[model samples]
Target: MTDEHPHRPRLAPLPEDGWDPSARELLAPIPRDADGRLPHVFTTLVRHPGLFRHFLPFGTHLLRHGRLAGRTRELLILRTARNTRAAYEWGRHVPLARAAGVTDEEIRRVGAGPDAPGWTPADALLLRAADELHREARLSAATWSALAADHDEAQLIEITMLVGQYHMVAFFLNSAGTPLEPGFTTEALPAATGTADDDA
Candidate 1:
């Protein structure tokens, strides 16, 4: 990341020494490398401390308090990452998606898209919802009804918010040129099969 993207980030991340007491307390739980530094996105976002403070609770809710199944949330997040061409987001979520029970093959196929063979009807619809929202900014009636069958009112609301949240996250990650930290999020984000629609 250093050499390949030395100047890619338009905004420099706050160096560790510059972290204040509040910043340190806030970032205490974030993963650190052998060098024990915070994640690139966190350090970078902290450059805008006010925005970071306000965004934390909302992001935390989607990540920790959402009603969707872990695997479901991960799927939406990964799909949203692909849709936005946010490689940083995609790389970060690959392991999380896997840990949440999404298989390696399934992860690969997500890039292939919701229509790719082998997805169960439910899984396909979930990914399709991501695609429809990404491309159209809203879900189709068919997709919505299909999702409604398995998800309750709260889960349904969670579904849209979770996917939309990642879209917002992706926008910042890409625009800010957030670098993937070493020993973390090193997965290669592959381009999906078709670029007439890509983001695999």
Candidate 2:
């Protein structure tokens, strides 16, 4: 996938300077207070703690426990990751995608835009929804019909929220220099494949 983020020179080691160690501390497994423990980005967002609390539960619902089918949610997330080229979001979700039964072929195809032929009908609709969401900020009637035909009301809402949430996450990760997870690797896609930009 493309890495669209602005480049930054690596900063020197932390903990040497007197800067708070809270950032690295949160990445540890042990839990801490809400303000003390979160993803690195969340910890940085502590400046706006109220927004953190607000998005946390809503983001969790769309991502962790919402009504959307696991694989469908992953497909949407994968599309968002590529659209934004958020390396860190892609790193975190690709494993979740695999666990949700997304194969390497499916993962590579995320960059393939809406018409890639190997996807199931549901998967194609999900991709179309992603495309529409990116280009128009909402799904078109035909795309929504494709989704609503198979998904219930709750699932439809969940999918909308999931798309919005992941868009936010991808923006943050890409803009804030959220590093790709340690030892994370993405599968390579075939060259000259159809892409979201081309479809757009």
Listed per model in order, the count of residue pairs whose N, CA or C atoms clash below 3 Å is 2, 0
> Against the hidden true structure, what lDDT does model 2 obtain?
0.69
TM-score of 1: 0.89
Residue by residue across 1-200, what tens digits does model 2's lDDT show?
A: 46455565132212213334443333343244344433445544433445755666677667668888799999998887777666667776788899999998888888886798788877888888887887779888998888788888988887787888888877766666755434454543234345456677
- In TM-score terms, which candidate is top? 1
Off by over 4 Å in 2: 1-4, 9-39, 185-195
In model 1, residue pairs whose N, Cα or C atoms come closer than 3 Å (at least 3 residues apart or on different chains), thus clashing, are 111-200, 192-200
Model 1 residue 184 lDDT score: 56
The CA lDDT at 37 in model 2 is 31
Give the per-residue lDDT digits (tens) of candidate 1, residues 4-84: 323378776778898898787777767775777777878888777788888888888888888888999998988887777
Best by lDDT: 1
